[model samples]
Target: MAKAKPNNKVDPNKYLKNKDIEPEGKLGVAAAVGRMGLMLVGIVGIATEFFRDDGWLKAALGKLFESTSSMMLIPVIIFVLWLLNRWMSSESKSETKKSGDIPMYAMMAVGAYYLFKLITTGSL
Candidate 1:
């Protein structure tokens, strides 16, 4: 007839002292979602403009912008997700690994492309 006693000496704060398990960096989801929402708003604006207009060419071009704007957001969204993944991963190799910074540049490139198109087309 032997009785076993439970160990009550485990300290929860001991885990907190370990830096390797701690989380770091920002999650890019909120930013990505916000950007997508802005792009959607831009698309809706373009669509409304098209429906309100009488010229076929102008309407078609407006719709192109509507669709393209959303398409352009796709890469940006992927980039954001990649960043969040890089931030949240705990593996040491993952910590040292870097995500492509090209998405930021891609956003700039898209902005420039749209600006150039708008200027050359004189559609604004």
Candidate 2:
């Protein structure tokens, strides 16, 4: 019987000590950019659809919410309250607030306004 030959291939992982570092090669950069482009396109498309007055998404949401009777606002209120709690309770004690929190603050204000209006007028 013939003896088996030894495998000579080197394991690349043995040389790569820091796996957390991103590859600096052209292929890696291209792949990263391609992924970012796809994500940006998808986000833009969704935003456009949401902004359009006659979009199917808006129409569908309107139809669905019409029968819910203030139930839809419950989730929005809960989410805004959660965001406020998270922002206030963050470990980092930074004097300046993040720009991302602007949208959350706006949502909280709007939700509070609607809640106040609902209580006062007894209508949506």
Candidate 3:
């Protein structure tokens, strides 16, 4: 019987315990989880708002986004766009590509528009 040699190379994440390979810090994990959780909550809230047909701008947004007033949408669209810009810029590539942030950003923009409307116009 012949014995086989073990492979020497391995994935650094799986093989190494060095400081550089480690996470920035424990708080990073907490912050990331918190951000993702908050995003999820926003998504679910809007999704719930959709099928109910009375939660506000859910249908209007999910549809072609036929808002009754453009004046009402202007500031909100601007603000949400700004927020999305900041959010997307700060995020890492893995997050932007794989973390589902784009769709989330889109949903957040819609939700934010309605939220802004809800706050300012007292309607959505």
For each candidate, what TM-score against the reference? 0.26, 0.37, 0.36
For residues 1-124, write the lDDT of model 2, one tens digit per residue. 9999999889979857786777599988997675555445445545555678788688867776777665588688789998877775656677555754665455455545555655789753
Candidate 1, residues 3-106: lDDT per residue as tens digits? Answer: 88888898878877686664543566666665665455455444545566575558655665687576677688789988787765547754543444444445
Give me the runs in candidate 2 sitting further than 4 Å from their true place: 1-23, 69-124
How many residue pairs clash per model?
Answer: 0, 0, 0
Model 2 misses residue 110 by how many Å? 30
- Report the lDDT tens digits of candidate 3 across residue range 1-124: 9999998987768645565675468899887675666566567656667667565566456443455564578789889988867755645654444334677666656656666656788754
* True-structure lDDT of candidate 3: 0.64
Q: Report every candidate's CA lDDT.
A: 0.59, 0.65, 0.64
On lDDT, the leading prediction is 2
Structure candidate 1, residue pairs in collision: none
Order of candidate numbers by TM-score, starting with the best: 2, 3, 1
